[model samples]
Target: MIATDTLDTPAAVGSSAPAATPALPRGLAGTPDDKEMLRSAVELTRDIATARPEVYWPDMLLSAGLGYAALAGAILIGNPVLAALSGVVSALALYRALLFIHELTHIHKNALPGFRFGWNLLVGIPMLTPSLMYEGVHTLHHARTRYGTAEDPEYLPLALMKPWSLPLFALVALLLPIGLLIRSAVLVPLGAVIPPLRRLVWERASALSINPEFRRRPPEGEFARMVFWQELGASAWALFVMWWSATHSWRPLLIGIAVISLTALLNQIRTLVAHLWENEGEAMTVTGQYLDSVNVPPPALLAPLWAPVGLRYHALHHLLPSMPYHSLAEAHRRIVRHLGVDSTYQKGNYSGLLPLVGRLARSTMLPR
Candidate 1:
């Protein structure tokens, strides 16, 4: 089970007098007043924070259905025009289904047991992105001490890095399918038999991480069981894909791979603008972590398409990591409506993804 500890820091929308940064963990500190204010704001929105089992089931089922139907129609139907139309739809639906993994990491275990198992069976195993890869790694990204640091497995300060790194960052997702396949088909089996190799795989190969130096510890207890089952499913899927391609026809598997690649590419773009990337591995104040994060608020209709699963309000998420996905917009609305324009919360809102990316590019290229 995931840790359900309440963060001591408050996640409020209103601004108050600046207080001295209170002592905190090695990499994070923030004013107690700030924490308290946020807590008050959060309490106001607490009713909506509970997960809705009803919403998750239909959404996953429909997206998975659309993705599979479109893919099958595209591959089996011989018409070029119909195939093109279906292919585009297939890519988007598949992307949405895969995106649900982000939500899986945050959802309360008791809330959606069947969805978790179904997700692993449908999108996770076939796409080579099992929940095990993200279960432990993603939580660290929200840790007050690790948000912008090298230790945060999911983080890398993209804007602060060399300009060349940006293109490499976006383009690298195209190679992920191959990499994931290698991890499942080659490394997983080998590591199970070899003791030394098992350590290396657990630490270096298991996580879905952006930080090159970050390493994960092997899971114990229930998490270890999760890893075992998920890895078995993914390995079996990978083997099936290989056998299917060799025996049947490559058309369907190729189309599925294309959709998965497209999903990764789209996710990579979302990750690019997720943060300002201003902190250079510093243990930041809680407020500092809030400032570095981004929220592409409404009027950007496309924002949800690219950063769905409640990711559009990313900064708010940093403030209240335990809040359920469906409730985030209501939490954001409640915070902003009550706090007004002058609030520190306003600092997290950006106009759109392109503007955020443009600002980061300019920040990196132009003299400060």
Candidate 2:
């Protein structure tokens, strides 16, 4: 079982004395916990906590199916305008499908039965992003002591970085498709013959982490067995695609890469605003992490298209990491209704993507 930290219970809502606050270095430390608000998040949302397989199965399958169908249309269609439109549709759908990897990371393995394997076969391996990349890695970002610290694989102090870093970060995602192809088709297969190379690839190249210094620990037991198969499947698929492109047609492969590149670019932009990215290297309190993270809640129509699944409520996810995506909206609603407008819970909620990105960009301009 995954270990969770007990929240520091503060005085009730509207209490004169505030919650305990942690002292940290320069950067946004976020507001102290409203213990009542945190309790309400758990108590009020219990009914909706269960992951509904009915919802999970159809949504993932439809998204993957639509993505591939649209990709085929993009490749085969003669007209430039129509093909471009098809490519855009393909990217958006596949992007949504790929993000199920995030869900796979959080959900209990038994919750959805064969959902993980189904997703790997349909979307993960085909996209060259096996669930192994995210499963063990993402949970660390939620670890109480690790979050916002250098130990967190997903946490980077981007808001504290130089202004050039933001654009460079987004631009680099354009090359991810090519990078994955090389890693799976070339590096991984080569690692089988070279033991040191195998260790380095597993430690360095296997995870889907943004932190430059984060090296993954080796997998153990069932997870290690799972990784071996996932690597073999991905490598086989990658090699087949490369050989087929060489023998048959380069057009299909190039067009597929282009579409996936657009998908990667979309995800990179969503990631930019996932957090305020202002924690530096501090070991933030749970409330502090929630505040530093963002929630692009409703009234933002375009958020669901880009930040699909439950990602729009990323801040809320920090609060309730085990909550399923389909239940987040209802959870947000219940918590908001209980806490009222003027609460620490409401503070994390932002208007939309551009404003959040603008906030981060402006933060970068401040003297470090």
TM-score (C-alpha) between model 2 and the true structure: 0.93
**What lDDT would each prediction earn against the true structure?**
0.80, 0.92
Q: Write the per-residue lDDT of candidate 2 for residues 1-368, one digit (tens) a residue.
A: 01223445677888898776643344455445568877888999999999999999999999999999999999999999999999999999999999999999999999999999999999999999999999999999999889988999998999889999999999999999999999999999999999999999999999999999999999999999999999999999999999999999999999999999999999999999999898868687788888889998999999999899999999999999999999999999999998989988898999999998999899899995
Q: Which stretches of candidate 2 lie over 4 Å from their true place?
A: 1-27
Q: Give the best candidate by TM-score.
A: 2
Tens digit of lDDT per residue, candidate 1, span 1-368? Answer: 01112335543557574644443432222222256447656787878877887888888789989988998888887998898788878878888888888888887888776888999998889788899988888999988778788898988867667777888899889788888988888888788799898789889988888998998887999988888999998888888888888899987777766766777888899898888877667676666677778888888899878888788988888888878778888888888888788877787899998898888777677553
Candidate RMSDs in order: 7.7, 6.4
Estimate the TM-score of every prediction: 0.88, 0.93
Our tally of clashes for model 2 stands at: 0
CA lDDT of 325 in candidate 1? Answer: 74
Q: What is the lDDT of residue 179 in candidate 2?
A: 95
lDDT of 1 at 184: 88
For candidate 1, the TM-score is: 0.88
> Highest lDDT among the candidates is held by which one?
2
